[model samples]
Target: MSEQAPLVSVIVPNYNYAASLELCLRALQAQTYAPIELLVVDDHSTDDSVAVARRLGVRVVQTERNMGVAGARNLGVAHAGGEILVFVDSDVAAYPDAVEVAVAMLAADPRLGAVSSIHDPEPLIRDSLVEDYRALQYYYWTASSEGSISFLFPALVAMPRRVYDEIGPFNTQLRETEEVDYGHRLTQRYDMVLTSAVRSRHDHDDRLGKLLRKLYRRGRARVPLYAQRRRFACGFETSSRAGGSLAALAALAALPVAAPLGPAGAMLPAAALAVSIIADLGMYRFVLRRRGPLFLLYFGVVHFVVNVTIAAGVAAGVVRWLFSARFRRLYEPDLHVRPSAAGEAAT
Candidate 1:
């Protein structure tokens, strides 16, 4: 961080996750990069999250009500004074070089709008089943072996002030996928980079219900984006055409197991079930290496349950978005076509 330029502001949004919040703030305070204003938005937490944040001496904004992550992040962005705005989750611990790399990367390229750190997939495996599902999803979204990408998880991403000017703040209505959608808009105008020099530790949820709920919300968020025919960011799981179908098929195949199935009739559905399960397992291994044999077995069961839940939610969201006229129009805001040649979708 150069002394001549404006300072950087790191915004962290927290709910009831007090333990995670403490870890996150501690990591921020210990950053090698110093020109940062740390602001923690307490979204009307019922727990001691506010007290914890206050104890840490970071600027705390207490919301009157519980706004989701997007809302909280927008609030933080509004209060940010830095030339660069970095958004971090309360549950993540930023690597020491987190701020340094982010600032340096963005400063290097005038064309760059945003830069994100590499998140190792260790914390996501603490709870084998749930963590594995979430880890797989996270890896699918953020992992890249090559150069910079346009969109990524906003968990530990940094963007220039110009990004907010050209694009805009996150959509408050979208509790999930707001980062993905916002990143897409930024990428349209400026380059989005992924720096190997930066990193963060993301904590994973071990609970089944929480994982299922998250997947459900993600499914709902994707409705409008996909309906508008937006080019997707992440891989197979995030895409509507591929991951969406997998989710739907997984549910349909499960119906036979719940009810009765004749031996011959059962084979096809049984085979489909096996294939889907195996495919997900393979994806888990390939994208996120199995921690161990025991961890893999437990994670496999959890992954199976999580995917079925996600598939069902995605199917419902897609149907609702496609059928509702208002939703379709809202999502697919019409483009003002210019008189230019080859009037395909505008950049």
Candidate 2:
């Protein structure tokens, strides 16, 4: 007889995303991996998400109250029967081979605690300018050299049961940047890989406003995240990106102030801004080469908006963190660990 494959539990935590939930479920059902259990944990979604899960014949675990994504995922882990846990967002549709590839990679390397698929935006990028920018950004970020990765989005990630148990659960208090926190914890013990071999389609918000809001929320969450993991403060994930954006915005803001001084003063800030844009373009040269000059028109505006909004959001988060004792308490790393009883139950 052949050795049995390990059971893989695919957990999807959803809110009011009924429209996209159906497609996400369908993709899970179509996964090539066998002995898979699909579980959808609903966080008191005020939509037809629960009904949709039930109609699809997948087990639905409804939280009594809104526990957010992190809490819902913890609840799912408690109820899971599989030895491997696969977390997929409601807006992501895994390719047929995604689970199989992730599982295979994890199986081949015992040290690999988790593996996240390359999120391809080709499927969702229609004629929308927002979509176009997102697609380009995704391409640039994920096209890095393969090996241990610093970040892993929960949108499509798989990990062994042991890894999750050891690392503990996601920080429920964090409505954003939870994945980064989790990834940081995982890297301390085991390795995480990002491979193009495994693919998934992420349905990003095509609306510019929605995208900016998302970035702002992510930026705000960074305050607490950075507070907990100080080593990551100057790391590529946070400081580099934020610093570059801030620099660009500062130069732009100085342009107006400098204009009143003299033409020479104005030229100084203008030169700085010009240098920043050129550096950004050079950094994303791969994108420019692939998408042609037309991409530059959209990228320039999108880059400015994203950086400016994120910087503002970070500022807001810092003020909130300073004023609210509750926020300060929540930023403590210990608050993120799974409780003893909950961890025991999950095991």
In order, the Cα lDDT scores of the candidates are 0.70, 0.78
Q: Distance from true position, residue 314, model 1, in Å?
A: 1.2
Candidate 2: tens digits of C-alpha lDDT, residues 1-347: 12599999999989998978999999999998988999998877899998898999988887777887888888888889899999998988899989988998899999999998777747443648787787667655565434567676688899999999999988887778778778888888988887778888877778889989998888877776676556562123545566667767677678778978897787777776665565465546766676777787677778777877877788888898889778767667777785323221211
User: Which stretches in model 1 have alpha-carbon errors above 4 Å?
Assistant: 124-129, 144-150, 234-248, 251-263, 274-282, 286-289, 329-347
Report the number of the highest-lDDT candidate.
2
Can you list the residue pairs that collide in candidate 2? none
Candidate 2 TM-score, true structure as reference = 0.89
Residue-level lDDT tens digits of model 1 in 1-347: 55675588999988988968888999999988877899998877799998888888888887777777767777787777889999998888988888988888888888988887767766722655566556655654456332556555678888887777557657665567766667667777888876557788788887778777887777766777766655666433344334534744655676767456666565665665666655555455754454666766775566666667766776788887868876554333232111112111100
Candidate 2 stretches with Cα past 4 Å from truth are 1-3, 123-127, 233-238, 321-325, 338-347
Instruction: Pull out the clashing pairs in model 1.
Output: 247-311
Worst 10 residues of 2 by lDDT: 338-347
What TM-score against the true fold does each predicted structure earn?
A: 0.83, 0.89
| Top-TM-score structure, candidate number | 2
